[model samples]
Target chain A: MRQLSEQEFALIHARLKSLNIRYIEVYEEIFDHYCTTLENVPALDSQTTIAKLNETFACSVVKNMDKELEKSVSKQVWIAQLEFLKFWKHGVKGILIGLVGFFALAISILLIPASELILVFLVLIFCTTGGIYFMKRDAMNFSFQHKSVSVSSIAVIKRVGLLNSLMCWIWIMPIVLSGGNILSNNFFAIGMAVATILSIIYSISLIAVASRLPKSTLL
Target chain B: MSNNNLIKGSLQTIILKLLEENEKMYGYEITQRVKELTAGEIKITEGALYPALHKLEAEGLLSTEIQQVDNRVRKYYSLTKDGQKQVTSKMSELQGFVENLQRILTPDLKPGFNI
Candidate 1:
């Protein structure tokens, strides 16, 4: 078999990129297929080999790539949704534990002076901010690990990121804006509890999806 | 070459069976193997082969591993545990289909019947 030169491989890679095979995984697979098919051709020039490949592959490479991307993206979305469901299952368990803790704390608050509630509220604010910080940091770390992620995978990541940000804004912003007085309100406390649980779940799902992305190199 | 419609439904089965026998194969290798085995009578197009492989991978019936080979990366696919189990059922289904096709094509060959 005639091996391709570095220049020849570079040309093929450029051609594939030009053809808009943007996904790293798809590009690698197609590039390998082209190389294998063109390996032992009589004339081993890049243009000729590419032309022959196009002819043999019926000139529908781009269309096929688009189809593959569509299928891949849909599959990723489906898997992410399944992961989200799993996260929700665990979130519910965590919420049950939190509920038990909340009742115990409430009983303790009855015995303590009302002035100590402010200290308790301050601690809640500090923990919420720390949780959001860690969530963002973990997500950033996960994204950094895979440098060449596909558009579909990026879309999934972006979706989770958006939800995480929105949850933080919806849940955290009001408390910050009210200068911690919102904690005194029963409705605000209940809403914050629900939002915090949801934020944790979203953050976990985001990290899970990010980790599931194929490695940046070959893929 | 067979009509695409005729080959489409059985593509996954053919792929699974090939993986079962070969243990592992790359995309082009699988296509070339099919062509060689069928003596060029069956041509698996690039457009069809890849999507089928990806679909099977997404379905968890096949798993892939990448290797750097002679300056380029090659992605090899093999049957997962589920895929191994799937091969038997898929092959038998194809077998039944072929038998039914034969019966339709040659009604005289139906059991106990003579032309």
Candidate 2:
């Protein structure tokens, strides 16, 4: 067996470090074993030792696959998803601003003559757009290249969120129905109550989920 | 050894023996050598191997060096002066264990077995 050259040795050393295997004993043991094996093969010498060592290290049983480790990693991903929802909920400042806009519309609903409900309608449109924008942007960094959320995590959250949101909507249906038709006097009152209750519940749950996650530094 | 065989307590002995012959080595190589020598009889995963290596290094018996390769890096390991002495001490301890086992097993060679 050919002995490992200085360069080859350096390369091997570098590779091992990358794997986070940083012990002097491990290095020496491997070298000794490689040399000992090489010595047994009369046709090979020190020059071939590295080649043998490389092959052996590449195929070593030390790099065994571990299912437990994989499971832990996936669990972490799940937690991160939960945290993202929390993060989104924590964007309460934005939500509050949107509510301010809604409040302004409320004043208009009461003070302005019923002939100009168009102003209230326009205000509602703008508030919804602004709330959605801030929720998307401030909740998580969603740039295409630097996207942090995992697809699995997003899928899981969306599934849960959809179910939860649907429940909230169901609870708010009475308010929506009580709003009555656009031509009715109870429209604004019922619309405001339904919107307020749903927003509060959604905000509280999202923030609570984000805050309750176990603190981990793996990321 | 069989899969059911337990080599937990003997890992240090095995490590010492390997280092006694070679001047230095690294984590990946040591694991590889054990597998090759044992012909797959024993396998050490990265998870188990790293902690052991870190513990042994912490005990002041091992030192490390970082070297850069073409596209990656690796760490090489070597024994300190104290580590060398440790090898001999560990070897004798292992020898004692084997001798005791032999004495217990080969009772026919004892003074009363033939009688």
Candidate 3:
């Protein structure tokens, strides 16, 4: 076999990294599996028997790495396939969400009372649209599973956002449905509407911040 | 090699040389072959063996095929044309080094140990 150029080895190293493989392990595999004969002993000056024994222990990892390199797939295709799976998963989720939302909206329109019908219809529409928009945007972001993330922060922020968005929709839409009855004695409705808007904005901001936080910093 | 450092340095050469001769080999098969030839002196771990193999395949010095064998999938690796040339050059360099070392350490061998 030929000696590898530094550049060539580096390239191979990079590919291995992408595959999430450890380099030392590769060397060990190779040494253990292929380079065993006395004739194949590495060119090194030491106690003949000990050299072989030490090499078995030393190249233990290095040879394994080589053996792995002998067996694994190229880094490029592996990453491509992973990315494809992620994209497909995102697409499936979006479709399922849309279908379920649509079905609920249809059922509500047919069964609900006239006085409450239009308001419910509009709320459902707003939620479906907002969710679809967010889903599409998320798909474009393309986060890798291997990439780090802050789970606690993300969860907190997401919870806040969900609450806020929910409040925003439930509170404001009733008034708009009532054709903007500003002077009405609907005090509870007015307060709920105000709280909802505030919560929605808060949630949106929380999510924005959450997305920017580095994975390493995540709790 | 004397120790880990030397093995690390020459690992690629060894892999390239083996592939040059055999054309292709699988992970387990390569491991077994090395053990057999060395008489169980060199031991390779599965952990380290896989990554390096992957890296070479990525560099285009080697190519691969994944085939199902006995209900399990196995990935096979083979050297490219450039890899073949590389193996030749490395082997010659290693041969020269060994010869030089022999002369330096055994200066009297030419006449005194000729028998």
- Worst lDDT 10-window in candidate 1 chain A: A138-147
Per-residue accuracy of model 3 over A39-113 as CA lDDT, tens digit each? 244434223633343444343444454344433432433343344334245587855864674466456544655
Tell me, by lDDT, which candidate is best: 1
- TM-score for all predictions? 0.70, 0.34, 0.36
For this target, which candidate reaches the highest TM-score against the unseen true structure?
A: 1
Query: Which candidate wins on DockQ?
Result: 1
Off by over 4 Å in 1: A44-48, A55-60, A66-70, A73-152, A161-192, B111-115
Who is ahead in lDDT, 1 or 3? Answer: 1
CA lDDT of every candidate: 0.69, 0.51, 0.49
Stretches of candidate 3 above 4 Å error? A1-219, B1-5, B45-48, B107-115
* Model 1 per-residue lDDT tens digits across residues B14-102: 99999999989999998889999999999887788888888898888998898887767898999999999999999988888887777
Which of candidates 1 and 2 reaches a greater DockQ? 1
Q: At residue B49, give the lDDT of candidate 1.
A: 84
lDDT of 2 at A80: 52
List, residue by residue over A1-219, the lDDT tens digit for candidate 1: 887777777777666655655456777777888887768565436577787676654437656765676576668666875766553466778668657766765664556444354455445544544544443342233442333335455445556557656765775687699997776776665555555555544554555565565544442
Model 2 C-alpha lDDT per residue in residues A1-219, reported as the tens digit of each score = 344456655555555544432223344344444444544555435456556556545534323212222233334445554555453464888578657856765676677654355344434434543443334332244454332232222333443456446644543464467662443445545554455444443444433443443221111
Using Cα atoms, each model's DockQ against the true complex is: 0.35, 0.05, 0.16
